[model samples]
Target chain A: MLREVVVLGVGMHRFGKFPETSLRELAGEAGRRALKDAGVLPRQIQAAYFANALAGLLTGQESIRGQVALREVGVAGVPIVNVENACAGGATAFHQAVLAVGSGSCDVALAVGAEKMFVGDTGRTIQALAASADVELTHDMGLQFTAIYAMRIQKRLASGALTLRHLAEVTVKSHRHGCLNPYAQHQKEVTAEEVLASRPIAGPITLLMCSSVSDGAAAAVVCSAEAARGAPQPLVRVLASELRSGAFRSGAGEELSTAARTVRAAYEQAGVGPEEIDLVECHDATAPGELLYYEDLGFCKPGEAGRLLDEGATTIGGRIPFNPSGGLTSRGHPVGATGLAQIAEAVWQLRGQAGPRQVQGARVALTQNSGGWLEGDSAAGAAHLFAV
Target chain B: MTQGVFRSSTDGEGAPSLAGSRCRYCARVSFPARPICPWCGREDTEPVAVGRRGTIQASAVVYHAPIGFTAPYIVALVELAEGPVVFCPITGCLPDENAVPPGTPVELVVAPARAGGAPVFQFRPLGG
Candidate 1:
């Protein structure tokens, strides 16, 4: 029998570009905050997993990233492992920590994700992101990331299932919620008109609609539920962790079903369904990506995301609040740190500590993050379901 | 220093056909030829030629192109009638509903890739 893992504490270094701040400082801030919140001393951490992507190419700090970052918080001599799985890096590390704690390999495990992107120039930054795709296939395409969603959005538009206004609305709502989140990279709210007026990066996705190339870190402290019993902090249960990578590409369809596969696995593990979810913090790398996820994850019926949005189901006061943390669009997508930041947001919401963006009485939360792109689907998809 | 995606050759009827790979064990087609079958992982793959005709399964308009590439270029993921989906740029195409809609018929053709020019496989609208 697997022991139930509990998140003792979670912390986030606000997602943004801090040119002056080093990656170590960003990771240390979040790690220290998590340890402090969990009432855990640095010496108590038995193992650490650091999650990051593009640091080697951009920062020249490749292996032992966890040791370099966690050492700043006085964690030493513990086994520090590093993992990189594109945008899912953070959640991947967190899942490893959960497994470590549940398997009795370690009583206390720390998962920290830090990424420093947008390095000196746009060309270099884009080149780093292109590593997520099969560079051999897509490198010459001269477009990274956003184009895939743009094509899907174009299809939706052609089908009359969506319009540019709908796309802009998604960005507007994300920014509106981001304003309530102090940790969000883009905190100021903007109108749909402003979103439409913003610079276009891909078809129907304006610059504001894209997740910022962010630099930040987030950390989580995990242990068995029994171990967290007396901790002086709110305990969030790690109900389920599910991960799925893109299957071998065939001409089956344009949309990759990794999210669907992972969510099903997660629901099975958690003994819950999408209908039971109270709120969500998903990877909205772009507006269309979120809309597609709503359909793929079965939050709503297939081809019904537009209607669901029309019903205001994903807004703060809606029946199922989505991306209450502003998602990647506004909260920022720091590649390595994004997944843990999502978990942090969920923990805060479950603890009733989310000041303005709280989803009332949120008891269960789901997080969906996908990374990299191959063929027409995400190469890696990781979904997490958390409960109080 | 650019090369064609496939070493094109004349078919039985003297029409140029795109070179690809056929799974000797499963018969699944791979564009530009892969030694191993992605669908079945069979290593008995043989090089074959594919006709240029395909349908536009998906498409995207990139407003912000990478370095040395111009913006506002249209690229599509095309599903060949034979097998496999090929993601390639569409010449003079747009992602508008009035243009380059999914399911639109396309024919692969050799075209200049960048400004200075290198031979590359591009697709063009068959009709309308």
Candidate 2:
């Protein structure tokens, strides 16, 4: 019989700029914490997956990044697979770990995502971001991601489906929630006017509306159901984990965003409707992104996202708590580590371990993350569902 | 970045046009040329000159630019007359209308890139 996998532990090293720390150090700290939380020693892990983006470019640590980082936590001589799936790197690593345990290849597995960003020149950092797009096609054209998102926003605006006030409200809500998350990069709450008044990164996209270039790490420990017998912690099952690449041509046509396709597969796999999800942590790389995802993820109907926001349906104490960990807008976007951070938050909410941001009686949750760009769509996307 | 992707020479009493690839089997169009047909996964594709005129599907101005690029420049997604969409900077616009709204019509032009950079393919408002 096939075995089930459960996340036995989750850990994070906060989300903020840390020029003093190295990637290995950041990863090591998160790994050790996860091991402690799971009550498992280094020797118990049969295999591991390490997720990191730009380690080679920014930190000069290419190849064997897992071996270098894991060795710091006294883990060695195991099959350590390195994963880089753009912004979905961390969750992809966790997905592989779940597969490892579910396939009975290993009883216990580890997944860690770490990065050290914002320590170099601003222009170089910006260039690294452009690498997410097509280098030969879009990057050389000098396209900025904020500009890319702005194009979508402009289209929506032209259709009268959304407004600038709705965009500002998204950031305002994120900041208010981020203030309660200890690991968030931007913890201070800001008014909607402040978000609009911030320096513009692109048309209609202010600096505050964009996710910060943060440095941090997040780790997870997973084990087979048999191996987790009598484990001294609340068992949270991995109900579903789905990964899909952006379509050059989707059945629904290329006009639909990639996240729309990825989320549908996840929901079908989990057999859970959007209404059943008690909480959610989605890839809000920009504030406008979150509003659009509400429709794409089926949280609302098309062109009704602004109405949902106005109704306070997405706030922490509302009909559904979205991004209780502040999301990328406020929690910080450490690219490689962002996905696992969402996973960690999901696990915490399920285990009732979340302190201030805890959703009352939360039973089911989802995390939708995507990154990279090509041909005007996300290059990769992934979504996972968790339940207690 | 390569200098330009469009041909400078004329084609049979026709105006100069952009170089793109079209799948012979599936009739799918790709900008800047693709070796394989992305739709049918076939290698049989032909080089074709795409029309120079396109409509602006969307537009935005970047205040934060990459290394060696100027800020607050316009970039628009233009749907070519041949049904291929390309991203190009829109030129010859009034300084105030940096972010062109969707549905504006534009035509192709080759110009020196920002700050004396490489020559890049650009789009200007139709009849502007």
Candidate 3:
């Protein structure tokens, strides 16, 4: 039988543009912090997984990414694995680390995600992000990821399922949450009018509603429950971890989205429902994405996500607080580092260590992350459930 | 302007049609024609023309363009007559609410994807 795994420690380098910092410096800081938090020596790490999505395209760093970065923090001679799954790269790395410990392959494993997008050219960064899609089919269309979200939001607006005001309100909420997060890139709260008036990037999607180009890193340490019996940090159990890829569907069929399917599998594995989830850190690359995930994650009935948000059920201290860490829109999306940052947020909240943004009495937390785009859906989706 | 994605009229007098693949096993159609059927995992598939005429399912006006693209251009997802939905640019209109809203009938045409760029398949409102 597989052994139970627990998160021993987590850390994050502040999420924002860091022109003066190198990718190795960003990753080294987070890794060192995690090791220190776990009170474990660097030599104790049995395996390592490093996640970086755009390094090859932006910085020209191809292979041995994990080994190269981890070595700066004194991690070496171990099975260092490099992971790249677009934006979900961090979660994929964490999943592998958990599996390593749970399957008895090792007692301790490390996961780190880092990205450097501020290469002095905005056009180059945009081009690299667009490569996450099926380039062959979409390269010529001048596709921007924001436009994909805009298309979805436009359909919902056309159907009257959502309104322009609701979109603005969500952005306002994200910014407000970001204000409480020290690591957030856009910490200043925005008003609904401000959000609406911000420069429009796509149909009904203003600049404030989208995640900005950012550079940062996040790291986590996982060990078998037995290994964590006497650990210093509060224990956070890994109840479930699920990853899934998009399935091709023709027409407007009634198939569940990739996010929905992945979360359903996680729920079944954890033997818990959405009602048990006290807090969440979902992939809100755009403001409307959070609203859509409310339904996709089974938090509410179809066509009622907007109503759920209106009820204030997703704000801090609400019934099911979401993105207490400001989500991608405000907390910053460093592509590869985003998923691990979600993990760091969830762990802090579960331990009651989250200061101002803490979801009071939070016992169970869930994180949902997705990456890339394919055939009208995310190419990969990952969901993990944790409890204290 | 990827090669083999679409076919132009031999006489150069008609609109281009997207080249897709139809599975001989499950009859699933995929745009940008796959060598093997995504559904049924069968290699028995044949090239077919698609998206000659379609209805706009969703659309957006992109104000922040990527490299080689101008800002404030319209992009859309159109459901073809054959069943596959293709993402392409929508031309012959301004970026506004009335710019080819969902459900508007459209037809495919070959146009420059960017200023002075190679021709790629795009969509335009029927009779616009």
* DockQ per candidate, 2 decimals: 0.51, 0.54, 0.71
First chain TM-score in every candidate? 0.97, 0.97, 0.99
Model 2 chain B lDDT-worst window of ten: B7-16
Candidate 1 chain A worst ten-residue window by lDDT:
A135-144
The models' CA-based lDDT, in order, is 0.84, 0.85, 0.91
Docking class of 3: medium
What digit string (tens of lDDT, one per residue) describes model 2 on residues A1-388?
1677899998999999888898898899989988988999999999999999888877778799999999977789999999988888988898889889988999999999988887767577767877777676664577788888888887678789999999999899999889999989999998888999999888889998999988999999999888898887799998888888887742223466788788888889888989999999999999888988999899999999899999998998888888999999999998999999999999999999989889889999999989898767788898899999
Q: List the residue pairs that clash in candidate 3.
A: none
Model 1 sits at a Cα RMSD from the real structure of 2.7
Model 2 docking tier (incorrect/acceptable/medium/high): medium
Measured by DockQ, the strongest candidate is 3
What tens digits encode model 3's per-residue C-alpha lDDT throughout B41-123? 99999988788899998999999898888888999888998888888899877777668887899988887879877777888
Candidate 3, A1-388: lDDT as tens digits: 2989999999899999999999999999999999998988999999999999999989999888888899877899989999999999999999999989999999999999999999999899989998899887887788899999999888788888999998999889999999999989888988999999999999899999999999999999999999997899998999999989998877675789899999999999999999999999999999888999999999999888889999999999899999999999999999999999999999999999999999999999999999999878899999999999
Question: How well does chain B match by TM-score in each candidate?
Answer: 0.78, 0.81, 0.87
Candidate 2 chain A, run of 10 with poorest lDDT? A248-257
